[model samples]
Target: MLDANLKQQLQGLLTNLREPIELVSSLGDDAKSVELASLLDDIAALSDKVSVTRADDDARRPSFLIRRASDAQVAVRFAGIPMGHEFTSLVLALLQVGGHPPKVAPEVLEQVAALDGDYHFETYFSLSCQNCPDIVQALNLMSVVNPRITHTAIDGGLFQAEVEDRKIMAVPTIFLNGETFGQGRMELEQILAKLDSGAEAKAAEKIAAKDAFDVLVVGGGPAGAAAAIYAARKGIRVGLAAERFGGQVLDTMGIENFISVQHTEGPKLVAQLEQHVKDYDVDIMNLQRAEKLIPAKTEGGLHEVKLASGASLKARTVILSTGARWRQLGVPGEDEYRNKGVAYCPHCDGPLYKGKRVAVIGGGNSGVEAAIDLAGLVAHVTLIEFDSELRADAVLQRKLASLPNVKIITSALTTEVLGDGEKVMGLSYKDRNKDELHQIELEGVFVQIGLVPNTEWLKDSVTLSRHGEIEVDHRGETSQAGIFAAGDCTTVPYKQIVIAMGEGSKAALSAFDYMIRLPADVEAEAA
Candidate 1:
């Protein structure tokens, strides 16, 4: 029996599907097969079809896509590729197709539904991660009310070339317009703000009003700083724009895995990175958002970047080196226990929990990897997962199984984080299979579930995969001319810091090539 939350989530997924979808199954005549056939029959009956008859292709057209629906008709989504956690997405897609109004409050929906212009959405995801479902569904819901908005979900695994070209290193990235607005699973209000024409237009105007630079780089994490350093080294007048100076890397305790750095704290590493960029001539715009991007008017011209403060920068080229961030459990006590003993990054904070009992939430590669890593340092490691089976690669699963101190608790939902004033102490959970409740005494919890890309601001500007990941060429050229993106924001394969730095360098070089080839007048003015 499925839980109510799971059932509702599944039903909402069915509504996301576009119309005229039929279930085709190959059946065999056997007792077990007959039972399966009966269930399939019932499912077929449950599917709702959105009709669109074509007058021109009345005889030869495929029934799946007929005529476009009129203004008031509900848009249905197509559900396919049901695998692992993605199976949940398949259900949500059906819900979108069925035209279910979002669970968002009426006032919020009304505010969002009032939009009239086009919204182009692209999301990038790696199937190996487990959090892409929520991000994908949120975008699907945004598309339901705003018919002008079209969404595309691109799988980084299948489209390696595209992902590498875009410099994507994480899963569940969303891009609004031509800039990054937010990363990971965003709230409805955040999406709405990006979708709002008047608000975004004003934000864009403010961004365009800022001083100009030869190059503008967004994100101040490793990737952004790396891009800034490289660009400055080339003798270009570069400006780094970031809401926060260190980005997500500052939240970490320590980073020991970054190559060449034997042992270092996350904040220390980010400080060094920031100093390196500042050492050069790169101008840093801390605590500022890259609200929007406007392509130069002339051929091979400079680009204009708008910031949240109504300041804009004119640059010969732009490099996006925004990196990925860890996803949160969002359960009770999670927010309260953050830093007081809860963390999202194991690679950065695993060592801090050494000699202590810790719980790893998630069952995929990251989860398994964290558990395996923690097992070597921590006194005890309990792996909690909502699913019954581990979805990591076989090799990783074997390694996890080999660990003696690691206990795998499958089909468990962590409902509460039990902690004391200064730090964590224990946790409460329930098994999905049975009604039995359980508790685990632990000092720390590492959320290794997945990552979300920081690319929500680029929705209306470029062609993104359905998951809001920027689409780039092998050299990191976005769909829009004179604009480029890289690092974890693009569809890159690995989310490692090393990989992000490498891709950031690549994007900088690509942007350099673009800047060098630009018309002398535009280049000179920006320079």
Candidate 2:
């Protein structure tokens, strides 16, 4: 049932519809279908501009077709219930079909409007995937801007056969022109760039020439962006090579601890980060991944950073800020129920499990924090840790313990994810001390084990910790003379954005100091 506040908000938004819209449901006699139909009925009852109708089952069941009454060519479809975070996608799709332009940057809209050729985007997603809606909405907006482009959002749970046929292992996987286009969250500009320039051809063209800079910052997260900005302020040539500019920040949801701002989202923060970096005289290279690091041949000589795109860049100093990704449990049924109910990000998917029971694996700072956060939204939270004691800070642990709805179980190792082939139903764990296996029924499972640093490409070039984190000193200097490391990829104690930004500044300063100490000839070449 929709909350009163949400219903009021929907009513206000729907009243602005310029054209009448029809919702055709091809639902079966299932619980999900009945619930979705009721939700649609409530939405239709809100505005005179909206109407609902039953459709033949010749198409996929549990599906919906949203179209404008004035346009017969409108064929936007939602393959499953648009609950959870996906509800936003449905709202935006309705607005677009009702003759409303999406709220996009003017430049982005111009680029989208100028696009030629028929581009079909088939985006597969789960309701729990927070990053999925951004991509889905972006593609839908593109379709609205140009008739040559059309997009369809497919729910992975309802379309199991299609997901299996495509061998899709993750949510928010997009297929463009009948081939896999991209995975996870992506910016509208990046998506347009990929479509404009054929992926392979673009890579070859960008890699054809070797660029040189005074400082090369790898990774485009907060750390790398800060490093590039700080170094660029020194009036030296700076280059940034990154697979995607925001790194793990793209996966994050609500961020309240980022200082000044009271609240913000991952995509919003990323847009600001990119805009700030662009404000500097930095050569930003997006979608370029560093494949290898070649150390300088001599002291104070230029070092080479090889990219996965076949391009290489030579720089006098380099700052390694390649971030980390969430660690996953290699247990059975874990992969199968990825987006169905097994989630990695609590902020992104927590609301989906509202009033439902869920379990969080691990007891570290991240895990306990997730548990505390989820407790507010979920009906019950079971926090399981392999260690006897929780590894979170005393304050966080205290806060977690205060939650009446949260249950903390120590010395428990997650064994397997229990699911019904389509969605997670529960989880199995073993008592490490007693060696007894037990199962707990829940709708969602959040894995907050830890993070894995993205430093595989730097193993041969820099010193690394046993866990693959780059080893760095207080000044963020790595073992290599002219190279520095920062952020979650380094030996930094914390993985917060502010800490990474500060470390990036330190790395840039350290690189600048190193360059100043170089011989006159080398410094001149660097400049």
Candidate 3:
């Protein structure tokens, strides 16, 4: 059932539809057919221009053929139920088909229209993945702008066989012509560049050669970007390698505690970070991950950093700033309901559940904080913790206690996320003390257990904590000489953006100090 608030928003969005849309469905006996039919009917009732039709063909049973009433060619086809965050994609698609064009740059549209060969893009995604929508929308808009390109957004859970055949382990995995093209949140320009030239294969093939720099910064998060900028300011050759530039910040939604601007979103902040780094002369390498770190043979020797792309880079000094990722709840229906109702980020997807009930899984500072933050936006918040008592600080616990709409349940182990095939509706848990099972009817679940640092690759080269985080000193210097570490990936206690940036600056300065004191022979060679 659509809430009054969501219904009103949908009404306003669909009110200006310029053309009639036909939702063709062939799922006669499928369970999802009823949900899809009901949703389409609701949408149709909102506007005089929207309608639904039953298709006789069984081959396209579960597919949605969204097109203009007067046009013979289908504008778009949704293969599965577009619920959860994907609901927004359906709305955008309808708007585009109803005479609204996407806000893509004109130059990008020109490049897209000039493409010749047939390009079929299949993007597999989970509803919970915050990064998937942008990639899906970009490719979808490309399909709308050029007839030569056709794209399909597939829900990974619904199509397990295809996901297995492709060996997809992550969300936002893009397949071009049945082969893996790219993965994770990518820019349209990067996608076009890869297609224009077989860059992916080329990158793998040209790895024997090594690129050298004075300072090498790993990870592309706040810490890495800060380190790169600091190093660049020293007028030395600096290199940055990142799997994705924004790190975990890309999945964040509303950041009220970042200081200064009061409030900003994750993607928006990442754009500023990227632009700030680009403003400097740093050698930025995106979509590249560090696989191994090899120490130099002699003092002040060039250390080698191997990449997953088979390429290697040499640097006199290195700073490790690879950040951490959110931990997941390994419960049943959790993966299936991801994005539909199972979310890991409250700030990013909290507004979607306005006036609806949701759950926060965890009793730590992050979980309690999420509960307190969500209470203002959501109708009700149920915080479930596995421990008997909340582990958050006293201050946060007090804040959470003051919230009337928030309920904290301790010693409860979440067993599964309860959901229909299309969306999450509730969750089940087991009471540890009573040995009884319980259920809570809710629309969304936010998992705030903790974070896992990205330091698996550095375990062999640097001293690591028992939890797999890199070990570093007060000056950001790691166990190894000429190597420093910072950010959430290190032994640093805090994981805030400001702290990471300050540590990054300190690490870059330490690297500079090491460089200046190098042996005269090594100094000459570096010069």
Candidate 4:
């Protein structure tokens, strides 16, 4: 229950859009109806500025709350409040909106060409947190799997007033046909139940729950995708869900070293892998980030993959191939100038700094590699190292020294990033010895000091290293039963792409081994 004071505050907060206009229009001494008209206009404008652009004008009509396809009878979902822990909930909501039955089997997708149905789902979320990427991916997957399930996203922070009016509390809250369906992380079975009960609310919401699958891959990265292709060839039901269809590879600019592929770009490699998986009956879900892992209760019990979108999935086995993200400097201006001037992963955004002065922060291999790489493209490269000595390999150290334009500043630290509104123009630095301070003007700054794994969201659900990387055994098994961790986020010594892929495969097989001992009715209970 909301406190009275909080409720009044909420009322005031909500008034930012509608009631204020009515109050102002009242000065004209018009009838109540006239003031109501003014309020309606305000609501219309607010909705337009924040809601997803529908495919057609009629598609967004107020009467057409839920759009159903003739074949895939799925409920279109729109998550309006998605943020923080709610990011995973948004994915679950998308699954429900698409009318997918819990625990989808490979044979199920192959037999059904189109999942046509009409259902409407609305979700709310915030954009400030990095975890929201998973929710965005889940919604995207729903749209792709079943065209009937159109998705509309609402910015919770941008439209705080509107969200308050809707009485939204938790993020990733889903409302089906104007009624609260569920909150927090939801599973496929729970979502189907909501649809089953929402029919009288004016949408043709029906639950066509499918049979459970043999293997359910939770990520669509190089590791996850590779695993799916391998499993599918073996005639296993493999479903791939990821924040983006390409995983971390999407942000990568080039991939010169991938075997069997010569001089290929990152996106191109992802496209090829994606196409290969598409050729099979694999259920590939893009933009779906798994929030939680519900391990099988009995032998042969299907695993449950819940998303922030309020959608849930059931699988016999789970593979976590969710890759790591580029580390941030955690500096004040780094957040503000993220895409503007501050960047991570030299391979991703290094080209933007070409012919421009840039500073690479860190002395490790990444920092040294970035400095050497940027020296060829940028006018100058300033490598700042806090440590008295470089930590990179000696061979790379010589290569870095060979670059005439690259300057190494040891025993120095970045105090702050200096920049204007448009872009980063320069930065301030201080000597670790506290003897000197200097400022340098540069167009861009790349932080390669280190990487922070994406396992913080997993919390104590799995084993994490002291540095937060997931702890995996030789076979990629974590401390927790039936769960596995892999990639740069894991305790693997080498943070190489090949290594991450290998660990991912190991984790998949481990999950498969765990699943085979579960009960057959696990999907029904999980749903």
Q: Which model scores highest in lDDT?
A: 2
Candidate 3 lDDT, tens digit per residue, 1-527?
46678778888998767777787766756777677677777777778888888775535446666777877353677767777767788888888777676766687788778878988888887665567777887787777777677787887756666655665545677888888788767877678767666555455455445467899999999999999999999999998989889898898766888878799867778889989998999888777888999988777888899888778888999999999998889999998987677877675456556677999999998899889888987899999999999999999999999989999899999999998886788999999999999999998899999999999888889999999998998899988999999899998898888888889999999999999998899888755
Across residues 1-527, which tens digit of lDDT does each residue of candidate 2 receive? 68888889999998768889999888888887888798889889888999999985436778787878987455477788887778888888888888876767686688788888888888888776768887888888888777778787888766777766775646778899899899768768779877776554555566556467889999999999899989999999898888988999888767889999889877678879988988999988778878999999787888998877676788888999999998999999988898678888776567556678999998998899899989998899999999999999999999998989999999999999998887888999999999999999998899999899998888898999999999998889999899998899998897899999999999999999999889998777555
Global local distance difference test of model 3 = 0.82
TM-score order, best first, reads 2, 3, 4, 1
Superposed on all Cα atoms, model 4 deviates from the true structure by an RMSD in Å of 16.4
The stretch of ten residues in a row with the least summed lDDT in candidate 4 is: 18-27
Candidate 4, residue 310: lDDT: 54
* C-alpha TM-scores of all predictions: 0.50, 0.74, 0.66, 0.57
Per-residue lDDT, model 2, residue 61, is 72
What stretches of model 2 exceed 4 Å from their correct place?
1-130, 152-183, 188-197, 350-357, 372-380, 393-405, 418-426, 441-443, 524-527
Which residue segments of model 3 deviate by more than 4 Å?
Answer: 1-133, 140-147, 150-184, 189-197, 205-210, 330-341, 347-358, 372-381, 391-406, 415-430, 434-444, 525-527
lDDT of 2 at 399: 98
Runs off by more than 4 Å, candidate 4: 1-211, 253-263, 296-300, 345-355, 517-527
Ranking by lDDT: 2, 3, 1, 4
Q: Give a tens-digit lDDT track for model 4, residues 1-527.
A: 23456345434433332111111111122343233334333333432221222232322112112222333334333322233333343334333333434334453333222444754456555443232334444443455455544555555554456655774433445565677655433433234434445322221111114355667776777777767776677676777777666666654545666666567655566768788889888977654557777676654455677675556777766666677776776666777676567766565345445577999999998799889888887899999998998999999999999999998999997888888875788888888887688999998898887767766656646767788877778877777566666677777787666676677767767766665555657545544
